[model samples]
Target: MTATPVLVLLDHAADGTLRPPVRELLTLARELAGDAGVQGVWAGDEDVAAAVPALAAQGVTTVHRLATDTDVHLSAVLADGLEAALAASGAALVLLVSSFENKEAAARLAVRTGAGVVTDVDGLEVQAGRVVAHKTVLAGTWTTRCAVSAPTAVVTVKANSVVAQDAAAPSSPQVVDLPVEVRASSTRVRLVERTELAGSGRPDLGSAHVVVVGGRGTEGDFSAVEELADVLGGAVGATRVATDEGWIGHDAQIGQTGVTVSPRLYVGAGVSGAVHHRGGMQASGTIVAVNSDPDAPIFEIADFGVVGDLFAVLPQAAAELRRLQG
Candidate 1:
């Protein structure tokens, strides 16, 4: 009999390395599996199975490697490979990160396997006869606990919500052969030139221990906030408005439509703080807000508040932090 598997989605980067979202999902997989076994699935240029040993510290026992190559990058192929792996491994659950590229894989995999699919779950627990995960609804105002409708469940969890669990020892990932079917579909998005962004020497937003965010209230300049983030040795974040206005990159946006993060500390600058935006970053362990206006909504959630303009506060804070560090 095949061993039970809990598939964790793997992110293949331009450098042919796994991204943190995949590791985050692996950590969650270990949480759900507990003493149970886990098997990971990845469809990419190289075998993701090679990284399984790193995941084993979190209790992952096996890795399913898909050797198929695709002319078009579609989630269908991922799901196709997953079905084969699930059937072969007898997985009780499959874990995924809530990302655009992987959504189709989770959706199609569920349909093909007749499994219950859950999306954007903030937390997971075992209750009654099924597994339960919490989902925030109505822009984080209402929280709902959703139970999986099937014994075999498919889950898409938000990024930065879980800790990265490590595997045992230095054992490398054992490779398992996967079966996949390549069919001609209208969904043909080809892979073009892929490149990595220049390293800013900041931690990843989704995985950072600390995050510093700025918004429209920054008065169209974030040099102050950026310096403060550097001082804190953390990643910089921005609101949707900052990204929309091109004040910051889209990757830096923090909101419902942006990257979800749960850091030890999060500092907001000049942000009024909308519910949608808060829905993503509210899970942060601590919140601090600096704004010219005391009435900004961000101050309500902030553990520390400074009622001053970000432009004035950030530079002073940065300089002070540098002096303190010396």
Candidate 2:
């Protein structure tokens, strides 16, 4: 008997390609499925059949294409389409990337299917005929394990929490067109317009290999840090204090209350490494802290440390990096 497939909801980029986070989810689904099959869902108005090959390369056995013109509201339509897919496929487990839209959709799906919902799950597996999720709790202080007792399990994995690896042997996935009719919801929320933020030409903060973060010690001047990030082809990050002081955009803030990032290299300048700030970046592969005070809390976690003023050190470091690149 064929094992029940794990349904994965994949997000697409503007060019109709699957996003990196979606690829990560595919990886997680593949692992969780194990002996079971892995299935994918691409929900949008765009023709994303081109993504099937990539999904197949990631171990997806089947792909369900749903055309939903979610220009009005995406979550409602996606939830409705996913519900239909679950009913048709009889999939017991649904995996999604922990993006804003996907999380909302997962909640709606749980409500409709009466499935147990788990969010921000970084670890998932099948244990003793049940789906178990491992999630960080209390601001990354502890890890809690929870099992999905319902018939269907809806879980969202944090972006970049899992690495995407190629399947040992690639197979072409059978693509199925799922007919879905989306209607406007009674909810007053409507998408009037979408203003895309101007591109910064830097890597996404969450997925960047290197991140240069500024703190209160920078005295609000991020030019040096920005220069270093630009030289390293990385993203710019900021502490909560710096963002609260309006020295940087809130989107760039990294902390317990802000977004979490897991970069390969993290460079913190003038940061004292408060628990909130450390919570966001402690997972980085290598940490380099630069602070005037050698006793700064950031030094405790830093793989390398420099006791100096950022203004004096950052420019010198940027120049050296530029010269090395040149």
Candidate 3:
């Protein structure tokens, strides 16, 4: 019996290097493919050859590369090339990282291939020649198992669900040039301007294993919280009230109205733990709360609770961590 190949839709940086999420996707793909082989396809305007080393290190043996214009929207064209590769490779399953761009592209590919699409897949396994996906739904209230019975299944996996491991021995992946046809719709949307966010030298909130978050109790001073996060090598997040008061950037807000996170460890300082905020981070592996109020709402869900001023607790915690590291 011949095993069908598993296809990976690659995402690369402007420098043509594979992004961390893409690396994580390839790692999961390798596991799901089992005895089956793994192949990849990337279509963009960057230097495709630059991504070869990282792909090879991740055990992707064959790659389909296509070059397109950077200024024009290439999702439509990318989907076309990807579907063609899927047909050519006889792939039964396609894996994509659940990013905004990939989500849109996966939807387009699903329509073209007539394949059942599943998004927010955090885990996957193959049983009896079927793919089972694990998804977090209903604002982290439920864990749902889904299976795509279609001949070809398209799945979008969330970032940071799995740790990426490098292949013991790297292979020089065979690169193939793919035929690209830029339809009128593909070029209709054009990028007019580009703005880059300043780097914070911390992992992305969506993927960080540890997160240190602040709330109204922060009193508009996040210095201690930021230092603690830096010491832990994690990202800093804030509650909606903290952002509303202009203490932290809205991008760092974590609540029903902001971004959702499910890190391995969540540290809440001076947080009252409103249901809205808990909705975003309640799925974390372990939660710790530091608040002055003994009856704070956050203490109800916290695995560990400390009743003390955050300004006093955070600095001491940071100092202790630094001493231990030293």
Candidate 4:
């Protein structure tokens, strides 16, 4: 009997590249069921020809390509692809990186395919010859193990939450073209005007080597934090309270309920370091805390820490960094 396929829904960036999470997803699938084959599904405007080996680096054996129409919202389109692919692939599992868009598509796919949908999955293991997926819930304070008894299951994982295992490089990835079909009634919202958030000037949060984050304590003066981030060539993040107070937009929040990040280094300033705050950041390679209180919980997770006011510490750090560069 042939082994069932474990397919990853690979999201293509504007640059026609596969993001890191898809690689991680392949790693997870390989570990969860070793004999099973790993594969990728993508819909993009640019050709995905160059991205095959990048997937092979993580154990992908095949790539399924569908032409993308930039005018349509991807989530709605993704649901259509997911329904068709899963129907034909003899797949036991369909994996997605648990972004907001992925979650939206997963919900629609689950209803359409009658498959169980699990979100925020961080680990996968086989127990009793069945896959058990691990997920964090309730602001990362609780853990749960979920198993799908159906013929198919859809699991969406938090970014960087799962550890990626290395796979022996496969032979050249097999690329197969797919003819995507869409129904008019299936489409809900039409794409109109799209706008990019301009001039935050921060580095890309997903792959940044360094990160600096502020919180409610920033009190609308993020200039110092921004300066420090600039010197370090890092990205800027904020707490939920910071975004709520209007100092930063909703995009900067990092926590269980927001974006998860795992940078090489992370710096937290004036953040109280709630569990929700730690949920998104505990995976960082190194951490530093800048707070006036010695007992702040963030200090507990820090590789280096200073008990000083961020208003004073940030500017001083930025100034010294700038001066040294000059």
Candidate 5:
């Protein structure tokens, strides 16, 4: 008996290049999909042609391109396209990169299709013919495993949950255009104007494999934190205090009320590891903390703790890393 295929929501950059997290999702999908094979759902306006080769290399046998000219930026509209793709592909499971926007899309899709939805999942597996998703809850204090008993399941997965690997045997995937009928209600809230933030050379804070965070101890100076993050080819984040003080953009804030990250490595510089901030990143695979205060709470959870001034320690660390690379 052929297993039902697994579908991945393909996210891409403006240039139509597939995002790194999408590749990770595809790799995980390949593992979950045995004989059923892996498929992609492309809902963006960018030309799907540019992403086909990369998708094919990731073991995707089929691409369900949404055949619609309407804007899919809205959650409801994107859900419509996803529903069409799900119907055409007969995929029992759909995986998406976890983000605020994608969580809205997942919820909308679940409401439209009666599918079970799980968000911020760090791990997924097929157990006893059921899709089991593993995630943290209650401010990362509790870990839980949930089984999707519904006929169809939609899961939003955290980045870096799996390492992306090319298929042992690649296949030239066939692109199938699926028609979408946009509901008028979906367009009720039209986007007026969009302002793009200036690009930082570093990776996105939410999905980066490595993240460097600064807190109140930075004293409104993030130079050391940024330098280390840049040296490590990672993203820079800030505690709420840093943002509230206008030391950094609110977008960089990482806390219970801000972005939740589950990167492979987390480096907190001058951060006190407040409950709100720790709730955001406690799930990281490896955590390192640097602070002048030996009694800082962050030391409690850090795999490696250095009781030193961040300004003094971070630059030395960056210099050493650069020298070693040289």
Candidate 6:
């Protein structure tokens, strides 16, 4: 029996460079597709030529470049393009990087095509010809394995969940352009202006493999936290209290009301582990907490906990890491 082709939504930057998560998705797709092969869905207006080499290296056999008249930023517009790509590629399974926009696009695609949709999935596998998605629930307290009953499934996978590897034998993938008819409803809301955020010269908080976070215990000083993050080459995040106090930009806040992160390693300095804050990062692979208060709530869930002043602990830890790396 031949495996069905799997399609991965290629998330790229404005300059046509593929994002880090797309490689992971392509690796997973290659495993699932087997001999049936893997295809890619490119929705952005960027030139697809620049991404061909990377996609081919990941064993993608073909790339479906969705050409749409409307802005693909709109979730509805992206869904319309995805529907066309599914038909073009004849792929029953689609993999996407989990994000607010991608989740919205996945939901809309599910409604339109009767495809089962799963978001923030950490793992996936085929069981008895069915795609089973594994995700955490109840604020990362419980793990659930859900099988998609529908013929088509759209899954948004979390970053750092799988290690991305290139195929042993690369393929020269052919790019096929498919024109999509934009729905009038999707064009109802026009995007007025798009502003790009200034680069922080650090990994993105939502998908970084390692993250260092600060809380109220930092006492409005993130120098220690920043130095540690830089040493580890990780993103810097802040608790709501720290952000509300104007210690860091709100974009760096991580919680239920802010950005959710599921990094491989999470380091919390002076974080008390509020329910809202824990809800965002509890799914991380390894949790390390450092706080002066011995009774801090974060210590309860931390895989490793230290009872010390963050100001004193962080610098020492960073220095030790630097020495070890050298």
Top-TM-score structure, candidate number: 6
The predicted structure with the larger lDDT, 1 or 3, is 3
Model 4 root mean square deviation, Cα atoms: 3.9
Query: What does candidate 2 score in Cα RMSD to the true structure?
Result: 3.0
- Model 1: lowest-lDDT 10 consecutive positions: 165-174
Q: CA shift at 123, candidate 5, in angstroms?
A: 1.0
Over 1-326, each residue of candidate 4 has an lDDT whose tens digit, in order, gives: 12677888887566667766776788887765566677778766666866766777777777777654533355778788777677666777889887887888899888887888888787776666566788766544577898876566888875566566668756467887666687565566765666755546666665456889998668778987888898999989999999889898888888877778777788998987888889888877788889888888988788889999899999998899889999
| Superior candidate under TM-score, 3 versus 4 | 3
lDDT (tens digit, per residue) of candidate 2 on 253-301: 9986787876778999999999999888776768999999988999988
Report, for every candidate in turn, its global Cα lDDT versus the true structure.
0.75, 0.82, 0.82, 0.77, 0.90, 0.92
- Candidate 3 lDDT by residue in tens digits, 135-187: 88766778999988877888998777788987766768888876666666766
Residue pairs of candidate 6 with colliding backbone atoms: none
Backbone clash numbers for all candidates listed: 6, 0, 0, 0, 0, 0
Runs off by more than 4 Å, candidate 4: 68-74, 163-166, 196-203, 206-210, 223-234, 244-246, 262-266, 274-288, 293-306, 311-326
List model 1 lDDT by residue over 1-326, tens digit each: 12345677666655546777677777676665655666777666664545554555556566777767663256777777777777777777777887766677788877777888888777887676477888866655578988887868888887666677675543345667675666565236565655557756788787688899999888678888888888898899999999999998899988877888777899999888888789878877789998888888878888899998788888988899899999
- The candidate with the higher TM-score, 1 or 6, is 6
TM-score of model 3 relative to the true fold?
Answer: 0.89
| Prediction 1 global C-alpha lDDT | 0.75
TM-score of each: 0.86, 0.86, 0.89, 0.80, 0.96, 0.97
* Model 6 agreement with the true structure over 1-326: per-residue lDDT tens digits: 13789999999877788888899989988888999999998987898888888988999999988887788888999999999998988899999999889999999999999999999999999999899999997788999999999999999998888999999999999998889988889899888988768769998888899999999999999999999999999999999999999999999999977889998899999999999999999999999999999999999999999999999999999999999999
Model 3 Cα shift for residue 289 (angstroms): 2.0
What does candidate 5 score on TM? 0.96
Candidate no. 4 TM-score: 0.80
lDDT of 1 at 321: 85
